[model samples]
Target: MRIALATATGAAVLAAGAAITTVTPAYAAAAIADIKIDTTVSFIPPSGSDSIPFTVKVNSPYTGSKAPDIKAEFWKEGEATTSAGHAASVTALSDLANTTPAPTPASSVEVKGSIPVSSSDKPTTSTGKWTLKVSAYPDGSTTAVSSDTATFEVKAATRVTSANVDPDPVYLKSGKEVDVYAGFHLEKFGDEKITDVRLESKDSDDYYSLSTGLEADDSYHDSTSMDYSTSTGSWQLRISISRATKKYSFTKAFQVKKSGSSKAKSKITLYASPSKVKKGKATKLYGKVYRGSKAWSKKILKLYFKKKGTSKWKFVGYVGATSTGKYTKSVKPKYDGYWRTTAAATSLTSGSLSNIKFVDVK
Candidate 1:
C-alpha cells in the first residue's frame, strides 16, 4: 500500500489499509491514525515549578521498512501549528523502553520526557491550559504521519485548606489550679510556605492560650495554667487562625464546676489492709470514696495488680463501695506484686484511685 505525504499540510498521510490507533484506557476507542501520547499529570499548578512526565508510544506499523522518528513538543492549547511555542527538546532514547529526555540516539528511540518548568513558568504567571503534541515522521521527512495531542491545565495557585482547632481539657474544678492546651493546625501546600500563622483570641476564655507562629511540625499550639471559675456552667473557648489568604475562627464550649461542687476528689487514693503477705494468702484491699467530706456510697471499683518491676497493671477483680463510702476486695496472691484500685466515675462524682501497695509473697 502506498501512503501519500501531505507535505504542504505538514501531516504525513496514513495508508488506508494500515492506521495508527490511540488507546486511552478511560475513554472510548478512538483512532489516532498513527501515534499515542499519555501523561502522568494533566493539571499543572500555575505557581509550581514541578515537572510533568509524558509517555509517547508509537506503534511501528507502516508499509515502509523505516520506523518513524517521534517528535514531542509543547505549546498553548489551540496553537499546534505554532512550532515556536513548543517547550520540550527531543532526546533520543538508548532503548525503546526509556522515557526521559536526551540527545537524539543513533539507533534507538526514547519516548518519556518531562515538561520543563522554571521561574518563568510560575503558576501566577500562566493560568491557561497547554497541550503537548507527539508526532511521528519518516526518518528523513518533516511531515508527521500520525500525531496525538494531550491537553493539560495550568491551574491557579491554590492555598492550603482550612486550619483546624482543638482543645485539650485539663478538667480542673473551680478553685483548682491547672493548665489547659489548645492547638491550631496550619496548612502548607506544594512549595507554598506558611508565611505567617497566628492564633488570635476570639474570646476571653481562650485568652489563656496564645500562639503566633508555627511549631516544629508547622502547627500552632498554646498552653496556659487555668482553673474552673466559681460556678457550674458552660463557657465558650474561641480562637482564630490567620494565614496568607484565609482566616478561620473556631469555638468550643467547655463546662466549669465550682470546687467541691462534685463528690469527686482531685485525685483518689488506694489502700490495702496488709502491706506484706504470704504466697497463696488472701489480702484485703479497701479505699474510701468521698464527695468532698461526704461518703459516696455504692460505687463500683476495679482492682489492678502488677509485679514490682513490671510496667503494666493487670485487672484482678472489682468491688463496690458500701453506703458509708468504704470499698473492699480480697485477692489470693499468685506471686509477690503491688496492688491498686480505681473507682469508676459517676455523673455526680469524679473517679477515685488508691495508692499502690506492695504485698510480699512468702
Candidate 2:
C-alpha cells in the first residue's frame, strides 16, 4: 500500500512539471535605436504669428505593426523647470504604421510638427538660447522609449525700414563747409537698444567718419568740412547702426559738385613724335598738361595703349610732368597701337583725357 501511494504522488509531480515546461513566454517590447530633431529656422523672432516648423526622426528596432508617437517641447535653456505654459508645445504628429518587418536592422520614420510663437510669448532677455526636447513613445503608450534635445536662439527682430541722406547732390563752394543730414526709420519686433550710429565715406582718399549716440527722435544730423582741398567725385555715405550683438549697415550715394569760380577745368595735349617706327625700335611720346591756361606742373600722368583690333586699353606706364608741365617718354614698339594720356582730378581741378595718337609698327 505504501509503494502504491508513492507511485501516485510521483505521477502527479511529473504531470505538473510537463505543464510548466509547455507554457509560452512573452516577447520583449520594441525599443528606440536612434532619434534626431531638425528645424527650418535657427532663431525665432518676437513678433507676429510665426510658425516654427520642425521635423523629428525616429529609428527603432521594433517590428511591431504600429509606429511610435513623437512629442516635442521648447523652452528657454535655464528655465526648463518653470511652470506649465512657460514652454511652447509642438503640435502632435499624425500616427504612422510601421511597414518594415523583422530581419531588418532598423526602421526609420519622420514626423513633422510646428510651434506658433507671437509677441505675447516674448522672453525676459533680449536674446537667449532655447532648447527643444523630442521623445518617442510606443503606440498608445505614455512611456518614452528614446529622447533627444536640440538648441537654438531667440532674438529680437530689427531692420532699417527707411533711410535717406539730405542733399542728394551736395553743392559746396571752394573753401566752404556744408552740413549733411541723415534720417532713419526702424521697424522692430521686440525691445532692443541701439548702441551706436556712424556715418563715413567709402573712399579712403576722401575720408570722413563720424560716430554718435542714438538721437531721441532718430534724426541723424552731422556736419563736415569740404574745402578747395577736398577731392571731388562720386561719394557714398555709409550709415552703420550697432546693437549689442549685431551691426547693420546701409549706403546712400551723393555727388559733390564744385560751385565756386575757382574751380578749373584741366586739359592734356599728347603726340607721338615718330608716327612710324621699325619693330623693336624706340619712339618718343610727349604730352603737356594744363589747368585752364596755366601749366599744371609737377603732376603725374597715366599712359594707356590698345592694339588696333582690341577695344580694351591697357596701362603701359606713367610719366611725371616737368616744371613747365611737359612730359616725354620713349618706348620700343611691339605692335601697332593707339596711345593716350590721362590726368586724375585734383581738389581744385577736374580730370582730363588727351587725344588718342596712333603709332605704326613696321
Candidate 3:
C-alpha cells in the first residue's frame, strides 16, 4: 500500500508541471497588431498654421469587433525615448462601427486625423529632421499591441509679401488692332526669381499671355495684342504670379476704346472728289492719313461700300497712301452706296478706319 501511494504522488506532480508549460505558450502565442502612419503635409510652415494630415492603419488577424486606440507623439528625430518623458502628443479612439476592416486573414482599420501645427513645432531656422511615434492599443487596454515611427524634413515657410500693378491705364487703345501693356512688381521676389506672370482678359476670347523680359531690378512688365470687339465694355485683368513653391493672383478693372493706330496715333479721312455724280460715270475718290498732326506716309487704305438703306458693307478696292499721306482712286459707280476707308494694319500700327459717309449717286 505504501509503494502504490508514492507512485500516485509522483504522477500528480508531473501532470501539474505539464499543465503549467502548456498554458504559458498559449498566452505568449496570442497575436498583436501592426501600425503604420502616413502624413499629407511633410513639413510645418513658418508663419501660417496648417494641418498635419495623417492616416493610421492597424493590422492583425484577431483584432475583433472592438477597434484599437491610437496615439502619436512628435519629437525631434534623435529623441525616440522622449514619449515616456511626456512630449507633444495626440490620441484617437477609433469607433469600430465607423471603420471598414479589410476582408482577409488579417484585419485592417484606417484612422484619419490632422495635427494643427506652425513654427511652434520647431524654429523656422532649425534644419533638423522631425519624427512621429505611433502606438496602437486595444480599445479598453493601456498595453500597446503595436508601435512605429515616421520621419520627415520640416521645410521653412515661403510667401508672397506684396503685389501691385504698375500704373496700368484704364483705357487701352483699340481699333483695327488692339494692344495693351501691363506691369507689376513683387517686392519680395528677387531679381528674375519669379517663375511666371500671366495677364488674361475676362471679357474677350483672346489669349494675351505674356512673360517678363529684361526690366528694372525686381520689376515685371508685359505687352501683347488682343482681340476686343465693340461689345467689349469693362474688362478684368486676371493676373497670376508664381514662384517655385507658391502662387498668387488678383484682378483689376479697366476699359478699352478705339483710340489710335497700332504704332503712332493717326486720324483717317476719306474724300469723294465730286459732291454729286450720275450712275455709270467714272468718279475720283481721295483720302489723306494724318498721325497726330503729321502725315502717315505710304500705308494701304482698303475702301468698303454699302448700298443706300443697307447695313452690310462690301469690299470695293484698296489703295496706297502717298508720301504726303494722300491717295486717289477712280471707280465707276454702278449704284447709290455709302463709302468708307480704313488704314490696313502695318507691322508698326493697329491701323485706323475712317468715318462712314454717304455718297449721293443719281
Candidate 4:
C-alpha cells in the first residue's frame, strides 16, 4: 500500500511541474528591436498637416493566434518625459508572431500608420526639436515590451505674398526732385521675425536704394527721391525680404519719363557793378529771374565766377530773389574774372542761365 501511494504522489507532482512550464511562454515579453524613419522627411513645418511614416522591427513571443500592437508616440523637446502629446497605433506584421515556443529572429515591416501634425501643434518659438518613440505590446496588455526613439526638427515657413511701387510711371524734369514710394506684404506660419526688407534698382547706375521694417499690419513701406541725374528709361526694382535663414526676392519693371518739354521757359539777367575796380575792392553782383515773360519772384539763383583767361567756372554762392524778382550780393574782387548766375529748373519752369558780366581788377 505504501509503494502505490508513493508512486501516485510522484506522478501528481510531475504533472503540476509540467503545467507550470507550459504557461510560462504565454506571458513572455514582446520586444521592438529597432525603428527607422523615412529619410526624405527631414523636417516638419510649424503650421501644416503632415504625416510621418516609419518602419519598425519587432520580436513577438506570442503565438500565431494573435499579433502584437505597435505604437508610435511624439514628444517636443521641452515636454515632460512622463507622457507624450501625440500617438499612433498599428498592428505588427503577421509573420512576426512566433508559431512555436522556440527562439526566432525579429521581423522588419513598414508600419502602415502616420503621426498626424496639425496647425494647432505649431510652436510659439521659431523652431524646435522633436522625438518619436516606437514600441511593441502584446495582445490586451497595457505595458510596453521595448521601445526605440528617433529625432527630427520643426521650423517656421515664410513667404512674401504681394508687393508694389506707387507712381508706376515716374515723371522727371531737369533739376527737379520727384518722390517715389514702395510697399510690400508678407506672410508667415510661425513666430519667426523678419530680419530685413530692402528695395534696390536692378541697374546699379540707376542709384535707387531703400530699406525698412514690417509694420504692425505686416506691411513694409519706404520712399526715395529722383532728380535730373536719374536715368529715364526701362528700369527694374528688386525687392528682397528675409526671415531666419530663408530669403525671398521679386523684380518689377517700371518706366521713367522726361517731361522737361512741358515745363515753361525761364530766363535770368546778371551784372556786376563797378566794371573797373582796384584790386581787393568791393563790387555789387546783381541778377533778375523770369518765367516766360513774368518775373520769377521768391526764386533761388546759383552764382559762379572764373578767372578771365580760365575756362572752369567756380561756384560762388546762392542768392535768393526778392518779391520784385531782384537779387544782389557784395563781393570783393581779387583778380580779373567773369561772373554769372543760373536759375535751377522747377516742376513748372525750365532752367536758365544769365548773361556773363566782366569785372576788371587793377
Estimated TM-score per prediction?
0.31, 0.40, 0.37, 0.36
lDDT of candidate 3 over 1-362, digit per residue (tens): 00111122223323423422111211111122333333324444535566566666654513444555666667653556555523333445444353456433335555565555664555335344676656665666676545666666654433333343333433343445455666654443121145445554332333345674535555656766654343233345555544344444555665443344234356788778674788878778787886444566676788899988888999988888887788888887777888888876544345688876666778
lDDT of 2 at 159: 54
**Clash pairs, model 3 backbone:** 262-350
lDDT digits (tens) for residues 168-287 of candidate 2: 666666556777666666554443455444444333235566655446755455656566554444567666554444455656676655565435588999989799999999899998
Candidate closest to the true structure, highest lDDT? 4
lDDT of each: 0.53, 0.62, 0.54, 0.65
lDDT of 4 by residue, 131-211 (tens): 777776767778665566767666544545566777877787677898988777766554445544433433223457677
lDDT of 1: 0.53
Itemize residue pairs with steric clashes in candidate 4: none
Candidate numbers, best TM-score first, in rank order: 2, 3, 4, 1
Model 3 residue 314 lDDT score: 95
Best by TM-score: 2
TM match of model 4 to true structure? 0.36
lDDT, ranked from best to worst: 4, 2, 3, 1
